[model samples]
Target: MQQNNEIPQFDLAEQIMAEQRKNASVRRKGPAKRVGAPNQKRKVEPLGHTIKPQPALPEQEQIIAEIVARDIKKLCKGNARSPRTSGF
Candidate 1:
């Protein structure tokens, strides 16, 4: 029986992996810890005065009507016929 001079492939690979793992753990050690403020829930305070709702503008209705019209036009363009002119 003769002793082989070279290490087996799996053995060589395992040695490399062990070295890598040791280096990784050494690098993972971080700086020393320091004391900080204790974590506490924030305290929320109510507003000193109540907020009143603003009155609606007279043009708001017209602006909303224009938006609906534009959306309808877009929907109609995607389809074969407009619902307003379509016959059921």
Candidate 2:
């Protein structure tokens, strides 16, 4: 008895790529709408006459000065410290 053997006629990779192309072409874009300009424009300040600055309260100014003094003391103390280990 003789038996005949034939290879299957199917390609998995080609079928997958064809399916992807079919899906991409079926996409529909949404409807377009009309757009209008902004209702109000921003105010432009003059070169030298910019925004006016508000003065800080006396109590607030004293607190801010004390905080700044503390920060300076911390920086000076850190710089005056000696290294724990000496290197060659």
Query: In order, how many clashes per candidate?
Result: 0, 0
Clashing pairs for predicted structure model 2, backbone only: none
Candidate 1 TM-score versus the reference: 0.34
Q: Pairing residues by index, what is the TM-score of model 2?
A: 0.46
User: Which sections of candidate 2 miss by over 4 Å?
Assistant: 1-7, 26-54, 82-88
Please identify model 1 stretches exceeding 4 Å from their true place.
1-39, 49-53, 81-88
**Per-residue lDDT for 1-88 in model 2, tens only?**
8776888789999999999988886664434643567889889976986687889999999999999999999766766684553332
Report how far residue 32 has shifted in candidate 2, in Å. 14
- In model 1, the Cα lDDT at residue 41 comes to 78
Provide the overall lDDT of each model, using Cα atoms, as 2-decimal numbers: 0.80, 0.79
Cα-based TM-score, every candidate: 0.34, 0.46
Cα lDDT of candidate 2 equals 0.79
Q: What's the lDDT for residue 18 in model 2?
A: 94
